[model samples]
Target: MSRSAPASQGSVVLQTLAAGKLGVWPLVFTVLAAAAPLTVVGSGATTGWAVTAVTGIPVAYIAVAIALGLFAVGFVAMARRISHAGAFYTYVTRGLGRPFGVATAFMAVLAYNAMQIGLVGGFGYITAGFLDGHGITVPWWLIAGAGVVLVAVFGVSRIDLNGKVLATLLIAETVVALVLAIAQVTHPAGGTLTYTTLQPAGLLGDEAGTALAIAITGFVGIEGTAVFAEETKDPSRTVARATFIALAMICGLYAFCTWAISVATGPDQVVARATAEGPELTFNLAAPYVGAFIVTIGRLLLITSLFAAMLSFHNTAARYFYSLGREGILARWLGTTAPKSKAPRGGSLTQTGLAVIAVGCYAWFGWDPLTQMFFWLTVLGGFGVLLLMALTSTAVVAYFARLRTGDASGVTSSILTGVLAAVALGWISVQTVFDFNRLLGLAPDDPVARILPALYLAAAVAGLLWAGYLAARRPHVYRVIGDGAAAAIAPLTAVPHPAVPR
Candidate 1:
């Protein structure tokens, strides 16, 4: 890939994505590319309980699907014009400023690492289970270790390559689960074709908002559009469409599958049964619905799903590092891409190496991968992304504030995004605290939940300190953080292609 001046920072490699990389609806592809529907099956009622604070299962699904969609309203609006610097961190840099970009980069680094390592554990557990079923015995750590290597190798490849692999795992696992759920719904172990526990009232019995929150987290892949902005064809159009369509598709599937789970167990008895079995009820019901094979499949796919999410976020983290490096905050080596592939080679390698070290530590420490890696990493990383979302929302408001000062077109956007920034950030903070083991009216074991939010606060403090140093010493680079992306983009068209003749 040739280096081009898209805008400001020099020598940022041009992208290598095909125009048709994403079809007419890349978001649709990404939605299916995500195994979100299967999350409900594997995560079961625990997820259902979290998302529907005050509503039923369907209501929880609808509320979150809608809120997530609404969040995308401001999100997609920004995607329209800002096509160059893709990733969530990039948007914050452009819309907000460099200091925030630094902060976002740190947060994203933490989050993506969590997602990657966490999935490895999830994968190991699933892989080990499947192997055990096949009459083979192997430690879960070995399986997870293998996944780490495979994902790292694949991470350096093209974006579409990752997409294709994810899509295949997504389809196979989802089909198996869906077929079983339908079979259960159509023919039950007992009597009635429908279930009362799954009824709208039962699912929505209480705590609908809380349930909605957890359910919505299942749709975490929705934000990938922003992350893949540069890698898609006609990003402005592709991203906007993908966002809405992905939300609809995932929400629809989750609603249907959970409903089926309720119906299969009988609404009145399903909750108690699920409670008795613990949260694994989603898979427990599946033994009859699809057969024992699906439990393995779900586990396998989840580990694979984490792999895909890691690859996706690996690209995201590298880009943020590359962008920041180009702006001179970090070492310039991080910004360099492979001359042949034009991919952020150095940063990508750095991420994989970091993950290796993390996995090694887990192994040495005799840590439970699921408990420490997947759970803690995911929670830590997830909140960061949410924080980035709120920050980006604010950045949009500020970016457009100048436009709305005189231009009517930007006024509505400014107002809308500004309001969203405050509200969304507030909700994220509240939920973080509420979920804390001691803070919430729940179990004492959840005490570790508090660490994630504190980590975020610490990262923010570091970002502020770094910003202050930059402002005092190298104010020029600090000032250009907002348009640092423009630096790369400007050079892309700087030399100019000949104009087309009519």
Candidate 2:
């Protein structure tokens, strides 16, 4: 393992990320925080019921969790073999080709940026509403701008420090959610606990696709478990354990809480309650049993949950930019790390700039922050991640087939898992596309639905064109598209394992 060398005599020097700083628990905290369980249950689930009029959200969460778990089998297998900060990009490059890898990289940037920036809008709207209830007259954008600054600060700090913050916030929010769920379940409507919403059969309806799509959004950050591989103590096992742990937590918590909501309100009235109260439905349901103090705490924790999500996604997006820049696919300067913190400074700054611009534009246009900025962008981001997962699943099978090493039975099982995951994920991606309008609460005829999904295709095409340019003009850089730090020294084919400084 060697350090990254300068690409040219006078080119910007690439710095390595801080390695061996994060362990399994830290990585798990970061992944879970990015998912933002409380916020997902409060706003996302409630919105799903109200907008999509879907009553099977609980079962939908379980189905998605199973699909993602299958996806992780091959995903983790690949991670053990190829360790890189650019998780999806590296996997796609090694398994598919450099052109597709570059395309995946661009899509990751766009998707993660959307997820991070969208959280700002959510934080603003929720924070503003919370303050308004207290007779404060602060604007949502103003609060959002402050959130952007906070995330920027944290994004450029040490990765483990960010993990600590996320862990604390995640723990608090999980407690609030558990307490609420318990209150909801114990006080079931009509003194009867119905298992209707928990059954898989509930997921068969006209709005089923929309419901599943919404559920997928709740797990948007699950794949990010591998994004921190470069910074982990043991990339081989830490990544796998953290990934499954985060997924299981997200699945169980979401399913139980959603089922409790249905039980508390009775299956017949859950949708109507969500429609009327929106995100407040959960708190309102439990306020009678738990009292106003815990409810108030839950409300405050929702704001913190949104902030945690923003910070987590900001780090994920910044690292993607850093990996791209280090590989010479983007500007070399974007690969530099802060000397003291060893954080991706250039990439963090770039992400911050994008967030500022997005928030400023939305505020200037006077768009509805909750619907247009938060819901639409986050849903679009989730769709992009879904696309990446489908492609990466195929890439897993291809990569393993090309290698043809390792235990024969294990390899065959991995290949089988990849095939199944690819098919399931591909179908879900298509379903999400068709139900895009429903996800956004838009009409079937709305052009925005078509336009939003088209952005990924455009990004992929642009990436391909750029890769072609690099292939002709800068063959050296093109040969190392997903090689991480080793890209500066030699081609990926020549490097068995690229090493980062401890």
Q: Each model's TM-score? A: 0.79, 0.90
Q: Write model 2 residue lDDT over 355-437, tens digit each, in one string.
A: 99999999999998887888788888888898999999998898888767654645777788999999988988888888888
- Give each prediction's root-mean-square deviation over alpha carbons: 7.1, 6.1
What is the TM-score of candidate 2? Answer: 0.90
Report lDDT (CA) for all predictions.
Answer: 0.60, 0.85
Q: Write the per-residue lDDT of candidate 1 for residues 1-502, one digit (tens) a residue.
A: 7666763235323344352466545456665554345544555333333322222455456555665665676666666655454666556666666667667767766666665566566667656766886899998788777876776666566444445555677777678667756765775547676644334453343343344444544665577776566656666677767787777877777777776767766656664665455335666666664666666666666555555655655665666667767766667788787776678776777777877888788888988665456544554565566666667777666655645545475458555855665475556446555654422224546545556567777877787688778768975555555354555453344332111000
**Highest TM-score: which candidate?**
2
Q: At residue 272, what lDDT does model 2 achieve?
A: 94
Model 1 alpha-carbon drift over 4 Å, by segment = 1-21, 31-40, 43-59, 157-168, 184-213, 230-236, 265-283, 289-303, 405-407, 410-414, 417-425, 438-447, 482-484, 488-502
Which 10 successive residues of model 2 have the least lDDT summed? 493-502
* Sliding window of 10 residues with minimal summed lDDT for model 1: 493-502
- lDDT for 430 (candidate 1): 62
RMSD of 2: 6.1
